[model samples]
Target: MQKTLSTLTNNWAPSSLSQKVFLAQQVREHEAAAAQPCGFSMYMLMQRAGRGVFGHLKATYPYAHNILVLVGVGNNAGDGYVVATLAKSFGWQVTVAALNPHKVLSGDADTAQQAWIAEGGTIRPWQDIDFKNFDVIVDGILGTGLKGQVRKDASELICALNKTDLPVLSIDVPSGLDSDTGVPLGICVHADCTVTLVAKKQGMHTGQGKTYTGKLIYDDLDIALTFNKIAQPSAYLVSYDQLPKLEKRQANAHKGNFGRLLTLGANAGMPGSLRLTSEAALRTGAALVRAYCHTDSRLSISIGRPELMLTSDGLSAQLAWSTCLAIGPGLGTDKWATKLFNETMAHIESEQKTCVIDADGLNLLAESQHAFSTIFSPKHCVITPHPGEAARLLGCDVPDIEQDRLKAAQSLAKHYNAVCVLKGAGSIISNGEQSWICTDGNPGMATAGMGDTLTGIIAALLAQGMSATDAALYGVCLHGAAADIIAQQYGQRGMLASDLFEPLRVLVNPT
Candidate 1:
C-alpha cells in the first residue's frame, strides 16, 4: 500500500522540530550506526530516501511530466536511479543523465543502479541530452561527501543547470556546496528546493547555504528515536515561538518593579541611534529607560522622547541607578566618545553589571585590542556585531567571517569572554560553549537604527533578570520576530527600524 501523508508527517515531524544540528561528519557517523548489525541495511535506507524524495517531488510538481535526473558516481546517484524507476512506473517520462560515466558504483549504489536498468530505464550521458526539454531537474550529482569545488565537467553542467531557469530539486546538499560550512565551493547548484535526507544538514540553515538550499525539506526515513541520541547537537535553531513567555506584572507594581536600563551613546550628530535604543528598552518593559548623550545632543533628543531621563552631568549617578547598561549604538571614536567608552568599561568591569555593546562601541573595541583587553570583563557583557564589525574585531576579512559564521560567533564570544550576537541573515548567538541561531527577522530589517534597537531590547531583557546568554538569545529571537511581523504589514521595502517598537512591546508582554 502507498503510504499516506500522515505516515510521513507522523514519522518525520520531530526531525525538523528537534533542537539539534549535526555536522556533515556527524551525520555520516549517525548513518553508519543506523546501518549496523541490529539496524537497517544501507540498501533499505537508500530505498527509503529515494522514495521520500520521489514522493515529495511528485506532490510538489504534480503537473511536471518530464524529470531530468542528474546522477553522479555515488549513493546520491543510487537515489536518483530509484527516483527515475519510480517516475517511469507512474507513466512519466524519465531521463537519468550521468555526470560520471567512468566511475564504478559499489555496494548499495551498485544495487540501486542495477534495479533501474532491470526495469528498462536507460541512462544517458550528460553530454547527450539538452536541459531545455525537461520540466523539472533533479540534482543528485554530489552528496554531503563533497569537500571542495566541483570537477570541470560537473561545474560546466551546474552552470548550465543554473542558466536554464528550470525548477531544480536537489537530492541532498547541492553539488559543490559545503554540507558543513554552508560556503559554496568554486561553483554550486542553486536549487529551487532541496530535499535533505536523514537529518537536516547544519550547513543548509546557515551562511551561503540559505541561498542555495531554497525551501529546505527534511526526511528522516523513519529512524528510531535513538538515532537522535547518537550525537549531541552542535547548535540549536531557535525562534521566538520556542521562548518562554514573561511573567505577568503585578497590578500594584510601580516603575521600580522592573529594572532600570541606561544607554550611553549619541555623540554630537548621532542622537537618533541612542534615542531608538532607550525607547526600545522602555517599549520592551524596562521600568525606567535613560539615555546619556553628549551635552550638545540633550536638547534635540529630549524634545521628542520626554519619557527618557536624558542627562549629561550626572553620569556617575545614572550609572549607579542603572541595573543594566547598553553602550555603542551611536558612540563615535572621537575624544568625547572615547572618554565615555573608557568610563563605561571601567564601571562595568568593576561592578560586573550586565551590558550590551554594539555599533561604534564595537568599532572602538576593534581599534585597540590592547586597550580593550585591559578595560573589559566578559562576566556580564554581550557584544553584538554585524559581519563588518566582526571582521574588524577578529582582524579578518568580511568574506572570511561570512564563510563560517558559527565559528566567528564562537570565536568572538570566547575572545571577549562574553555572549556574542553575530547579526546577519541567520544570526548566530553564542557564548563559546553553546550556540543558537535565530532564524527570524527579514531583509526589511536592513534599515539603519536596527542594531541600536536590538541593543536596547537585549539590555532590557538583561535588566529584567535574564542572564547574558538568555537575554542575547531571547532578545535576538524577539527582535527578529518583531521585524518579521512588521514586514508582513508594512512590506519589506520602505520599512523603518521604529516599526518594530509596537510589535516588540506586544511580543514581550504577549497579551
Candidate 2:
C-alpha cells in the first residue's frame, strides 16, 4: 500500500526532506530513475502527486466545494487532472480548465487526462470559465518545463487568474515561474499555497518566487529520500533550525574569553550606521566591541552606547587588538573612507584576521586597482553585498545579478575568494564551493542599517571562533530570523534596523 502524504506530517514535508533544493532539469532528468528504485512508474508518481495536492486542498479549504483546476499540456496538467478526479470522487464540483483543449498531451499526462475523462469529468477552455464562481483555483499550467516568456494567450490567462480573489493552490512549480532561478517567465500564478512535488524547486524559496509562492508545502510522494540520493542539490535551504549552536560558556569565562571585535565606519554624518553595526556585534556575544569612527561622529556614537569603546586615533593599535573586524557600514567613498578601507584590508591580509566588509567597503573593493585575490585571504574574509553593490563588484547590471542570484553569489565568492552573503529577499550565502539560502526574514528588513547589522553579526561569530563559511551561514540565518520575529511582533511596516538588537540577543542564546 502506498502511504498517502496526509499520513506523513499533515501533508507538509519535514525539514530534512525539504532542505535540499534541485534545479528543474535535475528533477526532470532524475525523477524517473529515482522512482524506479521504489518500484513506482511515472504514472504512479503522477497519481501520488495528484493525491497529495487533493489531500492538501481538502485539508486547507474543507468548505471549498467548487474548484477550478487550470492546466497546461504537460506533466503539470496531469497532476491537475488527478486533483480534479479526486475532488469529483469526494463529491465536490470540480472543473478542469485547459489552456488549449485541442493540444495533445502524450505519455503519463495523456493517461491522467484519460483517467479524468473516464471519471465523467469534462475539460473546459479557460477563456469560457467564470473564475468568480470557483471557491479555489488549482494552478498546474506551464510547470518547470517553461523555457521562456509565457505565450500571449497564457500570459493573459495568468494575469486574469492573478486578478481574482480566489484562493490558489499551485501544483509542482508555480505556473510560469522558472523553477531554477525563481524569476517569472512572464507573469506567474500567484498561488496562496504551492504544494511542490518530488523535491523543492530552488526558485520557490527565493527572489520573486517568495512573493508568488505564498505558503509553500512540499510533498515528496514518498520517494524524496530516493530522489535526494540520486540528485546533487544545487543549493540547500537554511532556516533557524539549521543554525550553528553556540557553545555554552564555562563558569570562569570572562569578557576576554569571548572575543574582541573592532567595528570601523561612520563617516562625517553617518553615525547611525556605525552604531547599529557595533551594537549588533555586542548583542551577538562579542566580548569587547570598539567603534573606530571619524572624529566628527564620535560624540553621538559614544554618548548613547557607553558599553562601546569609542576611539578616533590608533588605527594600527585597534586592528592589532581586534580578533575580528567589521568595516564599511557608513564608511563613505571620500578620502577618509578610502584611507580607512585600505589600511583595514592591508591589516587583514597581513595579520590573517577574519573580517566582514559591507556597504562602502564593498564599493571600495569594487573600485580597488589591485587584484582581489592578492589583497584578501579567502578563508578569513566575508563580503556582504546587496544586488546593486554586487553588480558593481561583478561589473554587471543589477538584472544580470538578479536574473540568476545563486550563480551571482557563487561568482562573487569565487571572484573575491571570500564567503559572500548576497543580501535580498532570500539572502544567499556562498563560499564558492557550497551555497545555502536563508528562508527567513520579511519585507520589514528592507529598511536602512540592516546590512550593517549583518556585517556585525558575521564579524562577531568570526571573533567567537567560527570559520568564515560557518559564520556567514549562521549570521545570515540569524539576521533574517531575528527580523522575522520582529516583524511578527510589531508588523512589517515601520520596523527599524535597531529593533533587531533585542531579538538578536535572545536568538544568539537560543535555548
Model 1 TM-score relative to the real fold: 0.93
> What TM-score does candidate 2 reach?
0.95
Clashing pairs in 1: none
Residue-wise lDDT of candidate 2 within 398-461, one digit each (tens)? Answer: 9999889999999999999998999999989888888888888999998988998889888888
Each prediction's TM-score versus the true structure: 0.93, 0.95
Worst 10 residues of 1 by lDDT: 3-12
Task: Write the residue-wise lDDT of candidate 1 on 37-113 in tens digits.
Answer: 33678788898889999999988888898999999988889999888888888899999989876677998888988
> Listing every candidate in turn, what is its Cα RMSD in Å to the true structure after a full C-alpha superposition?
6.6, 6.3
Instruction: Give lDDT per model, in order.
Output: 0.83, 0.87
